[model samples]
Target: MQIVGQTTQLEAWVASRTRKFHINEILIIEDRDHRHPKAEVIETRTFNRYIPLASEQSNLVDTSVLEGLRSVGFDIEDEEIHLGKLRLIEELPTPIRVGAPARVPSFAEVEDLLIKRKPHEGLTLGVIQGSREIAKDMPESLQNVALLFDKENGVGEQGGVPFVFDYRSMDQYPHIGIFGGSGSGKSFGLRVLLEELMLKQVPAVVFDPHFELTFDQEFPNLPEDFRHSFKKRFVTLDAGEDIGIEFSELIADDIVSLLRASSGSITDAMETAIKALHKKSDSFLTYSTRMANLAEALDNEKEIREQSRDEYLNPNDRERVKLLNDLLVKYKDKVGGFSGTLRSVLRRLTRLEMEGVFTSAGTKKVEEAFAKRQLVVIRGSMYFLNVFAFYVVRKLYRKRRDYRDSIQKGRPVEEKFPPFVIITDEAHNFAPKGDVPAPAKGVLKEIAQEGRKYGVFLVFATQRPALLDDTITAQLSTKLVFRTVRSVDIAVIKEETDITAEEAARLPYLSSGTAFLSSAITGRTTAVRIRVSKTTSPHFKNPFEELEEGFAEQDEKVWEAVLPSLPIDASNLNAYLTEIGRKVGRLLSFDELEKTLEDFVDQGRLLKVSTPFGARYNKA
Candidate 1:
């Protein structure tokens, strides 16, 4: 390869006759005075001299007309030359020498430039693009550190250096955002990231609104020795079952937030009713009771007044009337409103209760997971998680922040809470861009801005970057952008990250499992193919594929029960069906057994014979 064109300090063009230049491949330009400045190929092109650049011209001919030249031993591909445009990684004060030699650098020459840490020291994400050539020369520890996945093939051999991320650097540059469209490997990349975090034993809480974050199952197609089981390293918690909010800990704003998230929006009168009736020590039962009572009081005010005055009323009825009168007199000025407003607030509180948002006392299970340094996967619907996350994130963040603050000021600490990370999918729903009122958005925004100081960070992945909150998006110092076809999302990524125009233009065409990692930790953008995950979600199989596999499993079960009794006479098939039915957990009819035997015969597993008395069955 040679630098054939005029060269500048920042940009140059390299031409090769035999070798194809790859984008993002580092090249050392030969110049003794410049000390071989390193440049990365940003663009590449290949073309033949025989064909016109514009194939739509009137002089154009079909490719079949060119086939005769190949028979004469003239190949058009041999006339093709590869060209690459290079950008210096670090710009120099002066231009480079013209017509200088350019060559690939050895692993040692660019070790410091390419990787910041070894495989064991950082999160091994995947193989870096353009590193396949130099990976062979790398040390054994770095050589086969990761396995890549392909659709046509199973797991491909490790062909490049692993992209080990320095997660410790996240303290300096806090939150990580993953953006991509559907089928862009957005969720696949997230699973890989969480697996790495579990491998590192980073305490985390993953809000799984999709119910697809379980990691107990091992991944298929992995090498025997490389397989890992995270059965003990992670725990899955169902909302309202394993974890929930302690209603007593909530303030008026907490109640308002949860109510707003549950009902989409609350009226001003409903807000006033909540603030007036809810006390600092109120639980869900107490607060909801007060609202219901106020609405009931408004409905039966004249009856209650007359009942309290009537001497014929029983003592219990008189007591209930007296309390109702007192409540009406007490909140007459503060909660003076229609009964519908009070009923509206009561309905929202009841809805949250039915969904088990306040069924449990607290999130002690999540805290216990954190204390053990375990990854706690919290599963719930989008609405449930949104309502619960506001309470959970605020409580845990306050715990960590308070502990860290106490140590910094030399105050006595009452409790011990570890700093942890918060990860979630469908983050745009929680922290949406516009005025969409979601309860979780406020605390998530708080953690995005100030959580790093207390050793708390966020990993938010979403398909819609344009819909994610601007404040949170701006705080995301590291972003993994996968294939996105939407122009609006692409524009947001271009403005948010340091991706060059060339890379931005190629976003719609990137394959699955590939992403452009723009990180402040690396101080540059890297094209990366994500590594295979150690575990997959339980629902990873396509529903249609599951149907076929389910039938096969059922067939195997039935065949196993009948295999030992093979070669029996078809005359005794009824007796055999009764026994086979007991083993397969279902009753079988005579016609069903006859049809099954014929299927086995057609499949070459068995043979049917014509006997003098009747037909007979035998193994094939």
Candidate 2:
């Protein structure tokens, strides 16, 4: 190949004898002085002199005309010339030489530009596109690294340079954002990322709203050596079952936030009532009792005012009246309007209590997994996770930040907590845009902005970038963008990352298991096909496939029991029924047995033989 167009400092065109060129392939521009600048092929074109742009009398050339041209040795295939438009990865002082020879470079030539860490040192996500030429010279560790997957063809053998991400760079760059639309590889790529974190034993907390992050089952078709068991390295916790809020640990603001999450909104009056009624170390019962008493006092205002003069009041009722009087006198100025405002708070509190958000054991299991440097997967519904994530993330982040802050200021170390990464899918629901308030948005936004100082990071994956909070989206330095078709999301991605217009145009057409890793850590945008994971989600089977398999299994059990006594007619139905029922473990009646036998015959699993007495059933 040779440079054939006007060469500029930023771009040059190279012509190849071959008919096609791979976009994003690296080529070295070898000049007389051997400056050896590298450039990436961003676009390609191929044409032939034998075939004109269009036939004279038609919009396109007919096949018969092509056959005639091939008969004379003027075939279009022979004259095809492939051209690649290459953009320099690093700019030069002057334009590249007009006739510089362009060839593929060795791994050593592009290793620094392409990779920041080794497989074990970083996250080996997948193979970079168009790196096969350098694969031969790659070290053993980088060769045949990841098994790429295609939805239509299944798995393909590993080749090309593996894209190992420098996750440690999060200390400087901070958070990661994963963007894509539905049916994109957004969730699949996330699963691979979490697997790498477990492989490295990095402490992480994952909020699984879909409950598909369980890693106990090994992925089918993975090679034996590549197989990994994550049962011990990761723990899945159900919100309000395995982990929840310790109600006594919550303050006034915590209560307000939980109520907002549970009911979607909290009025100013309700907030004021919560602050006045909820005391320190107040459990769910304590808080709920205060709310109930205030509402009762509002309902019986005349009775409360006249309780001191009542004649037939019992001692129990008299003492309760005094306590209500004391509460009303204490918070008369801090809050107002008891029944409507306090009753709203009571309803929210009661809903959360019934959901077990305040009753179940708190985040002890999550913290224990973090201390052991294991991945903790928190599973719950969208609303449940929203309610729990705020408390969990805020509490954990404080521990890590306080530890780091104490070390920085030379203060006495109180309690030790390790730094960890937080990951969540469908992240837009947790941190949405506009004026709406989400439960986890506050702490998540804080972590996104300043968590790097404390070694706390975030990995938020969502199908809609447009709906995510702007502040959090801006803080994500690394973006793994999968197939996104929505124009609104595409516009946001273009403005947020270093992706170009060409790449943005291709977003709607990208297939599953493919993504663009546009990262500040790499300082570039890379087209990547994700690798096959070592573990699969427990619910990987399609619902339709499961339905078919269930029927087939039931039919097999029935066939096994019927095979031994297949030649049964109406006369022997009673005699054969008992034996067949014993084998099948269910009582079979004459009509039920005969109908099933005829259905099997209709399905071609059995045949009916004509006899002197009647038709007899037999295996096909």
Candidate 3:
């Protein structure tokens, strides 16, 4: 027989049953009378301390028992109750100031008797009928009770063990959210989750600003053919990678906005540029060759080969031109309808999705697998100025939506995208407030509102719940609240959560990694400690240090050489001419200017800060 620890049992029971089950106190009463130490005094509370008495317990003070007194109503004084080891306890007589000596008892007397006899030991058992209440013998370590949706063996009536949901269940809703603070192991957790998604045959598009989750080095030892094929799918966008652009597929608006440019105009420019670049690259074969050549050139020369050895010069435009020239050479054959090509490419790139595909080789013996299984690790360490995490989340949302729209409809319910779960690490950013056009906000809200029907679930992780939107904040069915130091966030969580007032005050003092999981899925809330992830072997970390230590020197060198040549004088006519010339050059597509200005106005920037007053020049 397995002798389970009382604390572990208690925790499991409470967490399994109630969304608010938590341990208040556990006193070990060295029950040396028995060979082992026994838990004598255990104090526990439900999510909402509204404890209901059992029918057996309530019968002790039933109306019939109270009205059967011999004497009429008499005001009673201090009273006591005595109980024998065998029979139940009876109430002691209460002395009256006057006549009858209170021969008969009132309801109060009977109630007091019942309270005293209410089994402090054997007879006192807290039976959890369903997943709501805790049995008296229930131990004290359970946490995170939830109404799980099983996709495999199916859900049972009650108290039965849960079965694992099949992988196809995740495709129903591919969006996921995860939140955590500094050193919270959020990245490690995400990596593991991604691995699970991939193994299940789900395709993924990841934006890794930190670069911790990208590259062959991060995910080692897989099938070389499969790994290489997957690698080709990655389209990195940063200053580092050769073919990589700085634009984001998730929030095209956000990325362009960061450039302090107009979203509409920038998006148009991006679309145009991508198509033009692709078309300008010769043929399919030539395009592939040139792309390879550009990648090689960037990797080999490290810097655009210097045009002059004697004269000091900046190499910015030289590198850009070289890269453009290389791209042209590659896509030279497919250059005609470049704009259309670009639009299609952009659309294809943003179709981030997780789906099950048939993997067994032969046509007859085909097996199912998940699509969108690639692991994306953006170079996040680039700069906090670039919201890489936000960028990735937005992209992920778009992918999920696209996948939902695709597929042959009216098929068997199970055959379609099965239920998928999304877990975001920095949940606060995904669900923020106050009139910001953040892509994550809309996607999170959409999932929160409609995900359940689609089997798309979300897990939000955040150190500060207060920063989250109230609607999204209020809808959390399950919550894992860790140790918090702020009063406001704690109070907000308490007010927002279903836990009792007593539990709120205790939230801020929990030990590190110890948290309370509360939700309607569980009958009560429970407090528990989570095991931390291992970080000794190959680990993922934001590449901030590398850029600072390794890349910064190189970036600075490149910047220095380039700064001297461009027009910089604020008052110089040439500066004005250059600025106007650049603006006019943009007239190659005048629509870009109008659209950008409009977008700026919509975002409150154009209005808040008037356009710089300058002498206007009209091009002849």
Two-way TM-score contest, 1 vs 3, winner: 1
Off by over 4 Å in 3: 1-379, 382-399, 406-421, 436-439, 532-620
Model 1: ten consecutive residues of lowest lDDT: 54-63
lDDT of 1 at 467: 94
Q: All predictions: root-mean-square deviation over Cα?
A: 5.0, 4.6, 24.6
Worst 10 residues of 2 by lDDT: 54-63
For each candidate, how many residue pairs have backbone atoms clashing (under 3 Å)?
Answer: 0, 0, 80
Per-model TM-score, in order, reads 0.89, 0.91, 0.37
Q: lDDT tens string, model 1, 31-126? A: 888899988888887657665641232234223323423433334455665668788888889987766789999988888878898877888999
Arranged by lDDT with the best first, the candidates are 1, 2, 3
Of 2 and 3, the candidate ranking higher by lDDT = 2
State residue 501's C-alpha deviation in candidate 2, in Å.
1.3
Q: Which portions of model 1 show Cα errors greater than 4 Å?
A: 6-9, 54-79, 307-315, 542-545, 560-580, 589-598, 606-620
lDDT of residue 615 for candidate 2? 82
Compared with the true structure, model 3 gives a TM-score of 0.37
Global lDDT for candidate 1? 0.85
Total backbone clashes of candidate 3, pairs 3 or more residues apart or in separate chains: 80
lDDT of 2 by residue, 1-620 (tens): 77764667887777766636787888898975537888888777765765566223233543443443344344355566566878888778888886677899999999998889999899989988888877779888786668877657676787789999999888888889988888787888999999999999999999999889999888777777778899999998999889989899888988888888788788898899899888899888887898888788777777787995677889998888887777677765577856878888888788888888985477789889988989999999999999999999998998898899899999999778898999989999989998787878989999998999999999999999999999999999999999999999999999999887878988999888789999989988999889998888877888899999997786677788998776677567889888888888888888888888888989998898988998888789
